[model samples]
Target: MRLIPTEEQRELAATVRSFVAGRVPMARVREIAGSDEPYDRTAWTRLSSELGLAGLAVPEEHGGSGAGFGEVAAVLEELGAALAPVPYLSVAVAASLLVSLDAKDLLPGVASGEVVAVVARSDGPLPAGRIADRGAWVLEGVVERVPDGPSAGLLLVVASTGEGRRGVFAVEAGAPGLAVMPLTWFDTTRPMARVELGGVPARLLGESDSGAAIDRAADVASVLLAAEQLGGLRRCLDVIVEYAKLRVQFGRFVGSFQAVKHKLADMHCVLEQAESVVRYAVWAADEAPDELPEAAAFAASYLGRAYFQVARDHLLLHGGIGFTWEHDAHLYYKRAKADEVMFGAPRVHRARLAEALGLT
Candidate 1:
């Protein structure tokens, strides 16, 4: 099957790329990355109100534009390409869980682009759930590193109450027992946080006993992340190709060299393969039930890691200038690295794939 994007999707991609270049320019990304708040509300509003990006993947029933993961993925790719600073992933993936599971009341602000929502999934060995005391739920645990936590108005935390209990909870960011502290992260385009939930009030989402909903949410997140990585990887190739054509070494354009040409060709091949995988994964996420896990696993383990490696390779091709703090290539590199382990590392995802395939 042909892997090229359809006219409409290409249009969508172009629109997103243009908007990011115009509105959240690279300079703005640098400014926010070095700032105390780091989150850009103006850029977020542009995505929500002007671009309708916040609702791209949300169902229509929840006041969203009623698009699917594929559409959302297309937009995310552009965001990654530009290293645009926005909370699209946290809202599209984390808050999407709430919307998908009939938790609509908690998401209109996010869908409308008025508030940012983030995920606080704990990294401890324990299972996931809310902590309750005296009949009132209180979140009291350490959520290792949460994305977009510093700017979010709501946090959907996945925690463990016991060995087998795992659940998703919605807690107001400013709730009495909650503390969100920004963590120094590698990817300035996306911020990370350490959450201290000490007796924070929470409301449970999805079925009381089943962890299926949370698993589905995770699957959606993994697939979307793969799409973002695809965009970043593609951009890295583009950056290298442009540089190779312009830069001269030994009194000849770098593109004239066989080694540079071979590397660019290899990068193109890897990016194309990853694009197809991400598209398939998004389709499986929306259509196939039993296949979702396998698709998500393939995306996380292969596409995600592959993209980061490609970005690093592209940077190396640029030499000393690529390593500088002012270079945009480093921004993409940081995001690519951060995305590799966002949902789960490649090794962890490969284990999941093995289990889904009945491979001991």
Candidate 2:
């Protein structure tokens, strides 16, 4: 598989970066994050529908660009760098889940960015949810910490079925007996909510045994998220380096000091390693599905640690300014810390990696 970006992918990444710079800069991020709104509707619509990014990985038959994960990863990276408060990651995860389930009917709206979907997490196999067929599929359960739950038009829930099997189900956000209550989270940039489904009509997708499908979705989510972490790490390095070069101490540039230089260098080393892992995972997502599990696990574990470390160092090196809420450093740091455990922590992923490699 080509780990290097092709010309088209390069253009796509550049365009996405430009869009982040022009539309979702830090000022806009703070505004949107601080507000009660789910996200920047205008910017998200333009990005998903106008730019057709929402369908970058959706098949053309389903109204998506028929592109692949590589392109999706590109957009994700840029969004990570900007800390753009959009539900693109949630949508992407849902798309991956749907694809694994071979459910293409929802792809049209998803590709068009007309329908926003987020995955609701359960503790484990049908942990606290049940599905019964009463002329129509109905779900009853409580899923907590659902990403983008408040803003999502649709929710893809992973629940245990009556057959003692795990399955994925879809429910409309406005469906009867469904309640999505927003939760106060550390990362204001990514919203979470608790969803209570009580006799809510839903659509069941995928086969009865959806374990593999769920794992695939998780793997894809991990790889893409790691790509995002890589972006955040890169941004942290950039900001810290820039600050070091400018900030003067005792009439000398801070970067010229040995201690500061070593810290920045260590961050850069981690950033470079993270870039490699994320890129390999991106390639495996499309070109080598068999390897995606291991690749994604590695990326997830490494980038989680890498981004948090760099973000921490970024804040520390910024002196007192970084500690203040006014600076963007804290935001990045929060995002990094939040992301580290968004899909289980680095330790969890390391265990997964070990299992995948038969090292357990």
Candidate 3:
């Protein structure tokens, strides 16, 4: 499979990069981070209407652009680099799950960016919450650390039914007996919340034993998130490399120092390797479905740690200023840490990779 972007993909990436750079610069990101709102709805609308980013991966029959995951991956990289405070992952990934389950009725709203949905599954081995079917389906229990939960209009909950079957249920954001409590997390760019359901009414989206669809969606999200981390990692490396070239230290450019040069070289090498892994994962998402499981596992496990390390090194290379809250370095550092654990931690994915390879 081609691991590199085509000309059209390159143009798409450049367009998204430029758009994010102009619209959601670091200053704008800081503004959103300090605001009470989780993300800028106006910007999100613009992305949907102007760029059609919300429908990048949805089928044409579903009011989407009919693009593949490669295009989605390209856009995600820019979003990650700019730390654009939008629910692309929450919405797009959820739409993917619904599509996989043949729940096309929900695709129009999601593809139009009118509905923001998040899967209320925790970062655990099993699905969260217990489901009951008393005349109609109802969910009762708590799901913690749901990404963009407070801002979501819909929640795709994974629950175990009375028949001991795992299924996905759609719950309205403001349904009675449902409480969404916002949580303070490390990354302000991506907000999270705790969802507590007390017999909240829900509609079943997929059949029982559709837990595999959730797992597939998580794999898709993991690969896309790794692409985002790669972008942030590249940005950190770029900023540091430029700073080293210009920052004068002890009568010479810091970059001229042998130690600094070696560090920069090592960082570049790692960045290239990480890019290869991310691109391969994205390709698997589009072209090679059978390889996607293992590819996603490897990308999630490797890129998370690789990106975090690069972010840490970038901070160190920037000296004391990087440690300050005012510097962008700290922002990327926090994002790295949060993303490292978002889908699943590196160790968790590594275990999955091992199991997928039949080692466990």
* Each prediction's TM-score versus the true structure: 0.94, 0.97, 0.96
C-alpha lDDT of residue 206 in model 1: 69
Q: Is candidate 1 or candidate 2 better by TM-score?
A: 2
Runs off by more than 4 Å, candidate 2: 124-133
CA lDDT, every prediction?
0.81, 0.87, 0.87
C-alpha RMSD between model 3 and the true structure: 1.6
Q: Relative to the unseen true structure, what is the C-alpha lDDT of residue 182 in candidate 3, on a scale of 0 to 100?
A: 88
Q: Clash number for every model?
A: 7, 1, 0
| Candidate 3, poorest ten consecutive residues by summed lDDT | 124-133
Tens digits of per-residue lDDT for model 1, 238-317: 88999999999999999999998998888888987898888888888766867888999988999877888898988899
Candidate 3, 1-360: lDDT as tens digits: 688898888899899888887888889889988899889898899898888888888898998988998999888888888889898878878888888888898988889898887888865433344435556777788888898887799999888765556788899889998999989898888899998888788888778778678778888989989988998999999999999989998999999999999999999999999999999999998999889999999999999998999999999999888899889998999999999998878999999999999999
lDDT, candidate 2, at 29: 95
